[model samples]
Target: MEEDKFIELAKKAKYASKKIATLPVGLKNTALLNIAKNLKENQEKIFEANKRDLEEALPLVESGELKQSVFNRLKLDENKMRDMIQGIIDISNLEDPIGKTLLKRQLDDGLILTKISCPIGVLGIIFEARPDVISQISALAIKSSNAVILKGGKESINTNKEIMRVIQEALDSTRDFPKDVLTQVFSRDDVKNMLSLDKYIDLIIPRGGNNLVRFIKENTKIPVLGHADGICHIFVDESADLEKAKRVVIDAKTQYPSACNAVETLLIHKDFKYTTELLKALEEAGVELIAKPESWHTEYSDKILSYKLVSTLEEAIEHINEYSSGHTESIITEDNKNAKIFMNAVDSAGVYHNVSTRFADGFRYGFGAEVGISTNKTHARGPVGLEGLTIYKYNIEGNGDIVKDYVDGTKSFCHKEG
Candidate 1:
């Protein structure tokens, strides 16, 4: 697809999203239920498409470029499919973010000032081999009243196409949403086209590896919501309870080693009392330890981990500020003051206290499902949920009120609600 075609499609989506923004929440929920039903009915088709992708990806996995977990995420198992449906159903139960009044104030005589949430219009998503993203992000966008354009990695093109087809079938059965509201583009040129459609696309969310994110950021005219890497950190302060720190650190690194929120660096206080015991525990667990001097600023996404010794909280803060991917960072300490200080000082999307960085998720944060883990500081941060998918607008009402009358002394009016 050409850039112009994507821009054209985005234009149509912007118009469609406005209509969806006004759609009743009940109707939207019904559509979500329908989507879940459709996905369940088409289980075999979904897995077959995924299997095709995996069969091809086996070579890539063996080459060491792709992690085994990536392959696992790509395969659509029975449980994962059920989880995807439940995710959609969960989103349906949440209150619609659009059309909710955020603030109300009196601006002038008979003029009602209101700020309310609204759809972001059109959204562009660039992702990796996670085909379930088709259902997940699509569900959130629909609930939030935004149109979405998706671009999956070439390796998962077939899988994405199959998923999109199912989604369209659901939408068709429901007939409550415009088919153009969601689409998948297969070409690299189409992705480039999507990046250039800023006039219609309000935001571009890139969810994948560093190079893909960087490419999207560099090429897009639209503002991107992204984090290039997940160089998460776990700092164990001297005041930390050894048992708590051990549990949290182990869970953070080993829970799902290949995930974005997984801890890649472990920092221990130079005076950390249980250094020997903690080190032995981590080593025994099979974490490939890379010490400082050799472990320059890095984001080891696999089983690899970097170990650093910090003399004080200040040093820990410095190390994180210098090396972290600004994703999730955690500090384990029993002292209240140290925990507060560390939480405030760490420059990360999420700062944890005596907890695993893995807890930095939209679902864990009470959102039904996450669109992505955002490391960006503004617009959206942390786990992006339905609320993150929207923007706000000013809705001002006046009863034959004139700006000139309010400006003039004779007509100086009190700012009060009717």
Candidate 2:
């Protein structure tokens, strides 16, 4: 599409977003339910589209042009289809995030102040091979009453198109749902265009590799909300239980290694007695352990894990704080004091104790679904959900209230919370 065409789409989305922002909760839920029902009824068509994507991706995977992880993510099985349909329904059942009263106060008689949650105007979502992200993100956007413009990876273009078509059909069938609430772009040039349109795009969320995220952040003036690198870490304290450590580390590394929350670095106390056994267990579990100083900063979204032997808990924390991407970090220790210290001192979105880093997910956190995981310090962090997509605005109600009266001491203001 031409640059002008993209600009037109963005303008339409901006207009639609304003309409959605004020929609009642019932209408939004109706749209979500329609989407879920349509997706379920058309599962076969979606699967056929996914098969085309997989067929194209398989050759690239064999030729080493695409990673196996990407290919696997592109392929949609029965289980993934079921999950996708169910996810939308789950989102429909979530509490409405908009129009919630966050604060209420009485400044003076007949003068009231209120802080109410409202939707962010527009969202720009760029994601990689995972076609499931389309439905999940669209559902969240609708539920939160925010408009979204999506750019999906070329590898899953066919699948994305089909899913978007199904979702659009559902939205069209429902009454009072605005058009252009969800739009998708399909070119690298579109990404460039998206970055430049900060006026229409309120937030830019890149859901892909570190390189993609870093590039988007560097190029865009828009506030980017995502983790550049998922360099997660796990530290084994001296008082760690060897069996627990092994179990947690193995699960974190092997359970969907391509996931962003997978453990990439392991830090073990030098004096820990089960270091040898833990390493051996990980190796036996098909984890390729690399112990090198240079490997500390790498996010191997695979079965590869980099490790180091630290002299003390302080050394472990220092190493993690220095190399971590501020995504997720865990400490395996039986000591309550050490656990508390580790949890408090680690400045990351998710800090866990005696558990696998894999638990760092929006769905697992019971948020229904996530737009993306964020490592940003401001706005939203961790797994971003409906609340993250919203910002608050102050509403003041008064009858002929004048600032001059307060300035002139004619009216004494008493700030009281109710």
Candidate 3:
């Protein structure tokens, strides 16, 4: 937990980053597939380790010291295990995001300029409860040819350790794979030390509660790539279908209420005729609806929802743009024009029409998997998969080219791109 030890790990990751940056795509995919196979083989070991974490977390949940939603995320079921392994396989199947030629230019005669995609050097990830993030991030970093150091919450320590062990075992079996491409740190001090080492860690991705993310963003000189809050919303327009409204709202709220993409606020147009019926359907499904104005900014992460009726579609758009955490938002409507207007006007990472906000996911978006979602304007936004983990650099191959010639206008240069 010492800062020196953490710095050592960061340095190793940086070294490993350079080593893995130019690896052939075939080796990366093989390593990823090996990880998936190992996870499938060692799932029982992981489950047993997860059980230990749950045993310790249960008391905290019962005593109200920990939120039940967090405990729910801490426990990994067979479904989650399957999804985790399959996600790794899917990532392996994705086109390698690194080393692709993004742009090519003919600078001049016997001169060429090329821009190619490359890894982001090193990533420092701090997340809570979800031990699956360990495997997902390892696969993504491996595929993207980036090195990563992970810091997980104490609640899932046993699970995280076991998953990382299996993943490392798989990586060790991989031919010529870098050893320190993935590192794990657990301790409050590790976080503090990680934030200070901006020289080594290129990006800090915090995937947890708002307070944890806010703390990291405030204290870190490293550029942070994550949203602090998941205050998502869904607006039901006046011409909305009653059935579609109920279906989308129910799925978005109850499908996996603890998910970051879950809808926390509902905005209904006042002219919508099925208000009473819609509210009744929600209550019958065990949703605790609150109409309080102050709850608009709240992320319940539970079956609780805060809702309000708006006078018009414009009002609904204004409210969402004002209070949404720039995460995901949805509109349930039968009118195509209204849906287009709402979709175009809302400023969020994802905007959907007549669909659940739960669709805001990397795997669901067909990017294989994600390290985390980003609300940042620059760099990665939405689900950060392989593409987001990469940046590009210019590579020019010239034969005795001189800037002085161009500067002095002795020879006019042609800037042509192919």
Stretches of candidate 1 exceeding 4 Å from the true structure: 64-69, 293-296, 413-418
Candidate 3, residues 1-418, lDDT tens digits: the string is: 8888888989999999999998999999999999999999999999999999999999999999889999988989999999899999999999988879999999898788999999999999999999999998989999999999999999999999999999999999999988899999999999999999989999999999999999998998999999998889999999999999999999999999999999999999999999999999999988999998575788999999999999999999999999999999999999999999999999999999999999999989998889999988987899999999999999999999999998999877788988
Worst window of 10 by summed lDDT in candidate 1? 409-418
Clashing residue pairs in candidate 1 are: none
Q: On residues 1-418, what C-alpha lDDT tens digit does candidate 2 reach at each position?
A: 7899999999999999999999998999999999999999998999999999998888899999999877766788888788778878888899999999999999999999999999998899999999999998999999999999999999999999999999999999998799999999999999999999998999999999877998999999998889888889999999999999999999999998888899999999998999999999999999999987475788778899999899988888888899999999999998999999889999899999999999998778877779899999997999998999999999999999999999999998899997
- Candidate 1 vs 3: which has more lDDT: 3
Candidate 2 off by > 4 Å: none
lDDT of each residue in 229-341, candidate 1, tens digit only: 98899999998898898898888888788788999999999998898899788878887787864555566667778888988899999989998888999998888899899
Candidate 3 versus the native: TM-score? 0.98
Candidate 3: worst-modelled 10 consecutive residues by lDDT: 291-300
Give the RMSD in angstroms, all C-alphas superposed, for model 3: 1.1
Model 1, 289: alpha-carbon shift in Å?
0.9
* Candidate with maximal lDDT: 3
lDDT-sorted candidate list, best first: 3, 2, 1
